[model samples]
Target chain A: MEFIFVLDILGVVAFSISGVLAAMRKGLDVFGILIIAFATSVGGGTLRDVLIDTDVSWLTNMTYVYVIIITTIFGIILRNKLNYLRKSLFLFDTLGIGLYTVVGVEKAISAGLPPVICVAFGTMSACFGGVIRDILCNDIPVIFHQEIYATACILGGFSYFALAYFNLPQDLIFIISGLIVIAIRISAVVFKISLPKVY
Target chain B: MEFIFVLDILGVVAFSISGVLAAMRKGLDVFGILIIAFATSVGGGTLRDVLIDTDVSWLTNMTYVYVIIITTIFGIILRNKLNYLRKSLFLFDTLGIGLYTVVGVEKAISAGLPPVICVAFGTMSACFGGVIRDILCNDIPVIFHQEIYATACILGGFSYFALAYFNLPQDLIFIISGLIVIAIRISAVVFKISLPKVY
Candidate 1:
């Protein structure tokens, strides 16, 4: 539980940094940067929660909100240093998506959604923040066409159900399923793995 | 109520046609066109419903879905004929925004949100579909910068509250406020009205 909590924070930080980077690339002002950062950090979860017809977490819980704001300010100040931290950021991003996918799947399962919908829920929760960011930045979503981004989360969703089917301990299942996503993303990036281009 | 229903269907058709134009401009295939059309038609209301934490209307109601699908087909078939119908399309679009704005505000009011947030909700419900369509087509949201588009919806929202404050009948307030949005948009376009450029 403590481990998941830490990963959740890491997910928020990773997403916030990504938002700051995208907004900066677009030359948005400080307010735009802040808005993008907030949206990116919470957009996916908020979307999933909305689909589940529940109160938005960020509206009710301010921990992630404060984290995103502080992170945005730090990212702006440290813009020059971002290049040096690329590797670390990539790792955090991978971990963030992995955790997000599992959490989304778990939420859907708890809500009694079907398996197909559960997998979709998991993938959207992990990826939709980037979708929102790219939309606001006026780009075709950067994450959508990338082979590994959605594919990794989707496979992570599959691994989750597989783990559950064998009746693995729930905690162990989550950690393992999340790790599978992280591993796939890392290995894909390291090896330059890609699916055949449809177009 | 029946008039509102007709206006709602008209809104869907207008939005679908706009989506088709956008997707066609981008040279997207038929599938892409269909997806974009559907998104444009329901994207805003779906977003509003999501924010209000309710079961999404389209998922529960098949009427809009069938309307969008049929509209997309006709939009494609009449692509060349659309040029002659530009005036009609513009009128429909204006009326669409007008009706959408009031409906959004009324929904927010029924949900018991604060007035300011309700106004924002109304504007978002009238505008975000275009935002989604543009994002998908890789353009800055076309509806956002247009002075009259959002301004009309916002003003309509204010009109709703103002009329209610004065103890107007609910139905009368809805009709009057919706007409205000339509009037604002039509006049703005006719007169070439514009907000001064920020940059």
Candidate 2:
């Protein structure tokens, strides 16, 4: 549990930096950049918590708030050096989504929601933060574009249910599910694979 | 209670149409238009419900979903003739914020949040749908721009608290608070009153 918590914080930090970079690319002010960073790090989990009728996770734990603040400042201070770290940041983001997907699925299952809704919730938890971030930045969400982002989460969600149905151990299920998400995302990016355009 | 329910439905319809119009202006497809309409109609209330840990209002009663469907179809069919009804649509939109603000404040009060949070929730309920709508359409929210939109809701929320403090009747408080919102919004538009740009 401690290990998962540490990974979660790392994910939040990675997403926060990603948001700061996006905001800086758009030349937003300091306040706007910080807000975007916060949204990118915690927006998806917040949305999932709300939908599931749970206390907002951040409100219950001040650690997430402090993490966002610290990350935003770190990201802004290191803006000039970010280009060199793009590959590392990308790896962290992929790992973050993997952890986020498992956490979302586990929460929904605990709430006794149906499997399909659980999967939906998991995908939403992993992807909606970026959706919110993109929206606030006045751009169409990248996930809604040709990217395989949400699709990777969805696949991992289905994998979670399949593994659980086979009576897999809980810890193994979490590890396998997270690995599947990371694998799919990395594969898609490396191969330049994307969903076909509808229009 | 029946009157409030009726007013709520009217507000939903008005916001749904507003969303459809916005999506159409952006040349979104049918699915995109309907999604925007749904978001604009129920997005605010859903946010409030989630934050307060209540069953989502729309999921409990299917009426909201049906209303969004009907409103979307109606809006798209009447799109060509909508230019002539801009003033009427604006009036409906204003009345919507009025009802929404009151409903949101009442709900937050029922949930036993602080008065400040209640007011914030009220303002969010009245205005966040449009904020979501604008984001989906790839624009900065109009309320965040120089518009007096959220300001009107904040004023109405404060008015509700003031009226309640005076020991006003429940119905009277609701009506007066709603009217305050409507009046402020209409006056702002008529007088070209707007917030000054900070940047």
C-alpha DockQ of every model: 0.14, 0.16
Q: Each model's fnat?
A: 0.21, 0.23
A57-101, model 1: which lDDT tens digit per residue?
664456886799899889998998989989888888899999999
Alpha carbon lDDT of residue A91, candidate 2?
A: 88
Q: Can you tell me which runs of candidate 1 are displaced by over 4 Å?
A: A1-45, A51-53, A57-131, A140-199, B195-199
Q: Candidate 1 - CAPRI tier?
A: incorrect
User: Candidate 1, residues B1-199: lDDT per residue as tens digits?
Assistant: 7887988898899999999999999999999999999989889888888888867899989999999999999999999999998998888888899999998998888887777668767887888898789888888666534545777787889998999999999889999999999998888888987543211
A17, model 2: CA deviation in Å? 0.8
The root-mean-square deviation over C-alpha atoms between each candidate and the true structure, in angstroms, is 6.6, 6.5
Root-mean-square deviation of candidate 2: 6.5
lDDT agreement of model 2 with the native: 0.86
TM-score, structure 2 vs. true: 0.61
In terms of docking quality, model 2 is incorrect
